[model samples]
Target: MKLTLTIWRQKGPDSKGKFVSYPMDNVNPEMSMLECLDVLNESLAERGEEPVAFEHDCREGICGSCGFMISGVAHGPQPATTVCQLTMRHFKDGEELVLEPWRSRAFPFVKDLVVDRRAFDRIIESGGYISVSTGNAPDGNAIPVGKEESDRAMDAAACIGCGACVAACPNGSAALFTGAKIAHLGILPQGQPERDRRAVRMVAQMHEEGFGSCTNIGECTGVCPKEIPLEVIARMNRDYLGGAWRERKNVVTTIAPVSDWDFAKK
Candidate 1:
């Protein structure tokens, strides 16, 4: 199949980006999007042209490293699929696929379709962990977890932090991503000890990162490659409200001027 790829090209974070169209005459229907890009890069290299820069690792879709807007839709038109898994067969012959990077203040543009997602790492660092003692691993059944809780935890754990949620959201909210991280652990017994503190710290960190507010428009989950439900956002709100209330006095001083509890209004 042949296709026209109108891709955003930016040399650096501060550089202006523009759409540059490249025509592909020998795209294989079975080739994944990244594989097709590899073919394009090979051609570019043979002609001494700079290859398109994009992020990818574990192209099977497990790493969440590969993502971008394809024709105004995050991760292309496929439902619950990553760009790495999207194949040329999904598009028609001579189709024009417009590719762009995730647009968000928290995710600064890098080069081409790549953007810095380190803000997600910072949010994880704020308190997305359990406080377990260093020693031999405990038996899995040692902590009795309810089946319902376990299932919900697993569902939330499916989030890959791909930034697709942020890109899809008109408000550029990170609520879905942040909520997933909080819920996966908050739903499990292993996370109870730091549940309240975890929600408070993570929410505060999310606000500090400059991500927009989530108005429950549901766009974030709509384009999620994992099909993560909006329930995680609700769970996050519940935990954040409870945590913020309990840690009101202490949190006020630490995250001053941020108004973390303001999220509850939304």
Candidate 2:
């Protein structure tokens, strides 16, 4: 198959970007999207032209490092699959494909289709860790977790932090990604001690990162490669509200006078 590609190219974060067109011919329909890019890079190198810079670690979609918008759709037209997993067969001959980086204030363009997603890392660092020791590996049976709980945890943990959710959201919200992290730990017994605090801190960090609020448009779930359900956002909302209530109660208690405290104590 043959197609035309209009790829965004930027020398650096401060450089102006523009779409440069290239004609791709003799592309194998069976080739993965990354393979097609490899072919393009080779041709560009052969012509002494600079090649397009894109991110791809595993090239198997496990790493979530390979991500870009194809024809305005995150990770191409396929559902629940990353760009590296996307194949040329999904496109028709002579089609023009437009490739660009994930656009959002939080995700600044680094070069071409690569964007700096360190904001996500910061958000995770805010409260994504468990306060458990790692001195030695514990026995699996020691936790006594139920199978259903384990399955739910695995489902939430499937999030690969690809930033597609933010890209697809019209408001550029990272609610899905944040919610997945919160849900994954919230379902586990070890996460109980910090559950409310985790929710509050993560949400605060998400807002501080300049990510937009969720409006329930559902685009995040629609373009997620992992197919993380929109319900995760709902769960996150519940946790956030509960967290807020606890915070407010704590504040009131801290501010209460001795007489009020004694009356309440009675």
Candidate 3:
């Protein structure tokens, strides 16, 4: 098989980047996407040219590190599959594939297919945690949790913090990501203590990081590798609203400007 790849190439964060084309032959359909790149890099090395830069780990799709825009989709044509799991057979014998990094103000390009996702870390640091002390492990059945509640919490917890949700959105929204984070903890009794403050701080950090607001277009859920449902966004909104009502007397601490507007319009 033969194919042409048009991939973005950037030397550094401040460098100007452009798409560079490469044509190759003898591609095997059974190879994973990263393996296909391995072949391409070997070819480039033979010609004394620099190879394309991309991110990957485990190559088994668990790390959520092998992320880049394939053709025009978040992780190629597959639904709920990461790029590392994407195989070459998805394409025809002779085809053209375009590759680029995740695009968002919060995720600046570091190189060809690598971007700075530290904004996500900052958002998590802001409030994506429970206040439980680090002590001895508790018994498994010490706290009673219904199956339905535990399942929902796990669904939200499935988010791998991949930026596909943001890349797929027309507004580059991080609501799905942020919402998943909030819903995971908000649904669990262990997270009750910081629930209100978590919503306020995390939402504020999300906006400050320059991620756009959700338009409810459903693109986030569509491309989510974890298949985290869009309903998580609704749950996030509900928790935020409930938190605000509980703290209505002390408006300054519980309400975030972005979330306040969203709640007011509702």
lDDT of 2 at 118: 77
Better of 1 and 3 by lDDT: 1
TM-score of 1: 0.93
TM-score against truth, every candidate: 0.93, 0.91, 0.91
Cα displacement (angstroms), candidate 3, residue 165, comes to 0.5
- Can you rank all candidates by lDDT, best first? 1, 2, 3
Residue-by-residue lDDT tens digits, candidate 3, 11-76: 876667999988878889888888889999998999998888888888887777888888999988
Q: Per-model C-alpha lDDT, please?
A: 0.89, 0.86, 0.84
Residue pairs with backbone overlap in model 3: none
Which regions in candidate 1 have their CA more than 4 angstroms from the true location? 252-266
Q: What TM-score, to 2 decimals, does candidate 2 have?
A: 0.91
Supply candidate 3's per-residue lDDT for 7. 94
| Best model number under TM-score | 1
Highest lDDT model number: 1
lDDT of 2 by residue, 30-99 (tens): 9998899999999999999888999999987788898999999999999988999999999999999999
Error of 2 at 206 (Å): 0.5
lDDT of 2 at 154: 82
